[model samples]
Target chain A: MATVIVHKAGLLTMVQDRGRFGYQRYGMPVSGAMDVFSLELANLLVGNDPGDACLEATISGPELEFTGSTWIAITGAVWDPHLNGQGIPMNTAVDVRPGDRLGFRGLRSGCRTYIAFAGGIAVPSVMDSQSTYLRAGIGGFQGRGLIQGDELPLGTYNALLPGNELPPGEATDLLPSDGLTLGKAKRKPRRTKIPEGLIPEYKHEQTIRVISGPEVHYFELAGLRSFLSTEYTVTTKSDRMGYRLSGEPIKHKEGMTNIISAGISLGTVQVPGDGQPIILMADRQTSGGYARIANVITADFTLLAQMRPGDEIRFTETTLDRARLFCTDRHRVIFGI
Target chain B: MKEVTLKYIPSGDSAFIIKAGDVISEEVNLVVRKLLARFEEENIPGVTDFIPSYNELMVCYDPVTVDYRQLLGIFKKCAADLGAMTLPDAGVVHVPVLYGGEEGPDLHYVAEYNGLAEEDVIRIHSSADCLVYMLGFTPGFCYLGGMDKRIATPRQETPRLKIPAGSVGIAGEQTGIYPMESPGGWQLIGLTPLRLFNPDSKPEFLFNAGDYIRFYPIDKDEFEQIAAGVADGTYQVRRTQKIDNGDGNRT
Candidate 1:
């Protein structure tokens, strides 16, 4: 069995998969990977299923020691990953041998990074998922984040290897030409990179698209205009539960911020009595009593998750049809359909 | 049949809200419950899950498999079918509560606010049958209705960092139990040893949305004994058939 020993567990590191669904009606949250695009890509690059469990690191990255040879990939943030004190590129698959040390030094951009092993992380699923919820403490590695000296068992590999597997080379070998390393040494694993054009650009400022919430009429026209026109900075209070934005107060039409508590889904922008928009995320409470202003489109959810504190974001109103189109387009990119 | 307009409003790209009415009443809640049962029977292709509340239902679906127009058409058909279906009876569950003293830190406060003795407050609370309006905010946390307005009091000025599980609280006109340890602002009036939510248990939740819950007061000694039985998994949750009043009200 393969294993990875944690040396320096950076900021917040936890195992996550697609998400835990079918339990939201019981007031249980669908906690999962914050950025689904990067998580899937990392899994695919390592020849694993798209929703395979992987490690999500915030701010910084972890230093790990591998016990057996395996394929790995790092995605999402612009972290400077290194293997055995040597620099490695992102969005590409790499091979690790026994005693190889993998770590990250500096974070250039983005808020979170995902690390995927060949067969996925072997963590017990509490509710058919390995996503760590943190608050409830019921999923992932011991239902919590990884700490120094922790050892995580890797999933057993039994699937047949692809006919044209290649051992990844330098950055120049990332293109399609002569990338295959077929019939190579057993220790030298195959590596490949996603096309450069497909890599999402992580920027400091972003304009997120949203659909009008069910209770949009509760807000005044001026308040709606201000919400769409102004740029809000992500506050420090932001977490996986919700992003508390700091900006102009979005006043209600009749000071009615409270509502009959209803189910709150991911990306629902809820405005409480304080008037600031709180965008509920993966780990948000199952339901809330605040008036929902808008919901971020599914296409931009991963982009929103990669946003760090102090990052500025502006809202743009879009129709539900357009949002659905964005979802189909994203699925095409991720699944290569 | 109630003459109610069920409006389907898009909540997001993947979810939509079906509003039964504007007010929280028995009529609206019955519609919500009936719709949930109908949807379950219909087994719509892409409707992944749903949350039924006091006056509305939030339906979440997989966009990859079903489009919004297709989902809307399915819901319309389900609504029509709901008219012909006979709604199921609401289940009745009895709750044993330890009221007043260490078991209920806010019982005296509630009594003082209502200008009555602590025992009188308990009698008023446990006398009437409570209706389960919805379950939200937390796992197995039921938003109960039918609390007598006489003992109603405002929430505490400062919320407690942690309220123990099974602690019954009163916030304004609503009465509920803390299914798990969490920060809460409701005024606690009693405690119950029953686990409202036990993931390892067969049925993770104790009460359904359209059930009836009646609380019966128990002494501290009885509470400890029941607590032990609960810990050993030998305590049987007391349940009985709710007798209907022949006027659409269940007792």
Candidate 2:
């Protein structure tokens, strides 16, 4: 039973797992880590399950102090992580002792970063996921992001491994706390780095892949051409819920923008009456009334998730089968299956 | 068996939209519900969830376990044999609404816009049984269809910053309960005492797509009583069988 204390909660840091599923029919959005690839990679670096709960820090990262010795890995959004004033590298596992402080500076690239522990965050899962749905105020860290002075419980996923327990009163600052002890022998830390080739490149401008939405025909030829040709800039109002894009207004055929509200997914590019496109994300409502012009492909969602406001995005059409192949191929790369 | 034609449209690489008809109708919705029920019973591998709207049903699936062609084959087979499948009856829910005065805020405007008296507005809104076309926009939010066209009013020119949960509103031909606090443009006419959506509650949502809803007016005292009962976990919404009136009763 380990715990970590939060000193500064950062811009927005919330515990997130793979996602909440099998409940979308009940109007529950599958809130999860926006960038699944990075979340899973961080978890894998620390020997945790792919779906293990991790801290997703947005814009800025949280400042934390470990109450017990544990392993951690940071991935995504190139946040300058530091442990006791020592700069730490991203996508690599690192060990921290009791009373060791971990902090972050301004982000270098991307929008969200994931910090995973060897043993996942021990938060009660609501509807079978630790992911936080902020709008509903349910799941994750008491149904919200971490706050200053918050103590986050960490699970023990490696009980069978050699003990890392410590002796009594060894660390002067931390008292002999229950469920934790000072270790005698300092074991050499084990670390692993993700291959450079496997790391995704985050840039200011990106071309995302998409398949024509069910209502693609609702747009005229000129609108379709413009949608493909134009580069849409992410607006300032973008959040975990959705990204509002400002570009050439996609002209719809007369009386075509409005639709009977229907189910929406993670990457649905919905064009409303205003003609601007909104790409629904993790915290999006289960359904929407706007006509979906296209859906960003599954593999490209990781690329889209890392984008920040003021970034430009262009869409390229891909076939359904090809998109499925891209997704399977990415899974194979991540799981090595 | 109803003679309905369902067109399978690919919503995305990972989902399919089974369109029952071009327009929203009870018959089309019934077909969508039947397909959803059949898909649930079939327990198709890789199928994640089914969302049934007014005239279409969206089926989300895992691309890793299922491909577009294979999923289409399964859906096509289901559509072919859908006529023989028997589905359970949709639930009928009774919602008690407190219309007009402080709770609604926009009830008078709606009445004035429709050129009808406040009482006439309430009666017209409550007399007809509404269909829960879908649970969308928010958790437990029901998109209802059955507003008397004469009483229909346009939405507020400027949207309210925060519309309280359980607020009933009208936007064009549709009527709905907010279920949760959200910024909306709909012209609100009433507020329901029941908790339509609660994460802690069993079933979590009060209304599901395809459920029949009937709104009955309640006094403020009764609203307070129901609200207290709901807070204390003793309240239960009254439900009854919904009879269908033939020959263009509600389209």
Candidate 3:
């Protein structure tokens, strides 16, 4: 049982995989890594499955001391990562020896970052997912953020699968289901350096792609136009649950503010009576009553998750068909599927 | 069987909602549940998860493994076959609750607002058999229906950040129990000595969607005893098979 010792615990750092699925009907939100693309790439660099659990840090990254030698990679958010007080590259694998401390200096961009080890986090998954839902106190490292003195057990799944855990019959359901598993113990060549073209560049301003929501017709003509045409800044009240944007108030039609509370999804842009739009995120409730105007497409989920508070963003309309194409393109990049 | 009315609406790239009807009624929820049962029975490949709500069922699928067009075809087939669907019997869970005093901070306010005595308010709330419209907001939280309008009360102006688990609250026409401590605005009337949700236990959820809850008042002493029993997983929760008369009208 190898462990990663937390030296200086970073802000809101938690273990996350793709997320917990098959439980939404039971009132559970699919809690997982904020930026899925970055997490998947980070895993790839460390010879882990695309859906392997990794440490996700918000704003500031954590300083961890490795108990054993392993290959580690950091991705998402532009942060100055340091290996034993020396700067290391982002989006690429870095070798670590026993007692070597991994730390970060400064965050250049993005709100969340991922640190993926060769075998991924060994935390026993809750409901088949290592993703943490802090509110419910379920999943991830003790269902909460990383704290100092917390020693994280690391799983050995990168280079080789333990003899007992092989075969599709024994495979567990993980977020972004992995297809890279081989039947035998063979050295899984991890990517030492990722191609420059594959990396996502974070910016202060971004154009988020979305489609009309279930109740888009309930919005007034002006509200609909304003929602697409205007620029909204991510408010300080943003987190994994939802991002309450502060900008032009997108009004609903008269007597259309409320709807029967129904099911909602990730990236649902629901507008309350106050006319302020809130983009549901990783930890949003399973269902909501507020009339929704638009929903961010699945392809742009990674792009939206990386945006920080105060970052300017505008909505661009995209059809579901086009959205599916973008999602397939993403899978091709990471999983080659 | 009632004529099923459904409209399939795409939500995002990976999911879509099957809107049963325009309004929130027992018929609509029944239809939603029936449709959900079929999907469960079919266990169609590529269709991953579902969120069955009051008047809609949100189906989440993996676009990479499933073809959206073919999935919609399966959904349409389900809708066409829905009229022949028969609902499973609903389970009635009798939950013992401690009303008023420290457990119910807003009981007096509710009574005064509704121009009734505290006893009257308690009688009205406890007498009605509430439907489990859905379980949401947090795990094991019941989105109930069938609360008598006489005891209806508005939510608190400022929601409490941490409402304790097993709290019975009423907001507008809806009465719900918080299975876990969460931020909520409903006016609380009592506390139930039951674990609505516990992952470590055999039944992770005490009750699920499409179930029924009947509240019966108990004293604080009994509440404590039951709470202790619940904590140690010793108390047997009271349950009865819902008498399914025609038209979902059970009194």
Best by DockQ: 3
lDDT of 2 at A35: 91
lDDT of 2 by residue, A1-337 (tens): 5689999999899999878887776678888999988998888777777777899998888999988777789999987789998999889888777898999886778888999886678788787788999988899999998999999987644333444333232243233222532121122223367876787899989999988998899998889988899999999989998999999999999999888778887689999988889999888888988999999887888789999999999989999889988989887887772
Candidate 3 or 2, higher DockQ: 3
Can you write out model 2's per-residue Cα lDDT over B75-129, one digit (the tens) per residue? Answer: 8887788877655555678889999987888889888998989898899988888
Q: Is 1 or 2 the stronger prediction by TM-score?
A: 1
**Model 1 lDDT, full chain set:** 0.83
TM-score of each: 0.92, 0.91, 0.92
DockQ ranking from best to worst?
Answer: 3, 1, 2
Off by over 4 Å in 1: A159-191, B245-251
lDDT of 1 by residue, B119-205 (tens): 999999998888788887777889888899999999999999989999999999888899989999999999999999886677878
User: TM-score of candidate 3's chain B against its reference?
Assistant: 0.93
Alpha carbon lDDT of residue A117, candidate 3?
80
lDDT of 1 by residue, A105-183 (tens): 8788899899988767777777668899887777889988999999988764432333535333233222332332221
Q: Model 2: runs farther than 4 Å from truth?
A: A161-191, B243-251
Tell me the lDDT of candidate 3: 0.83
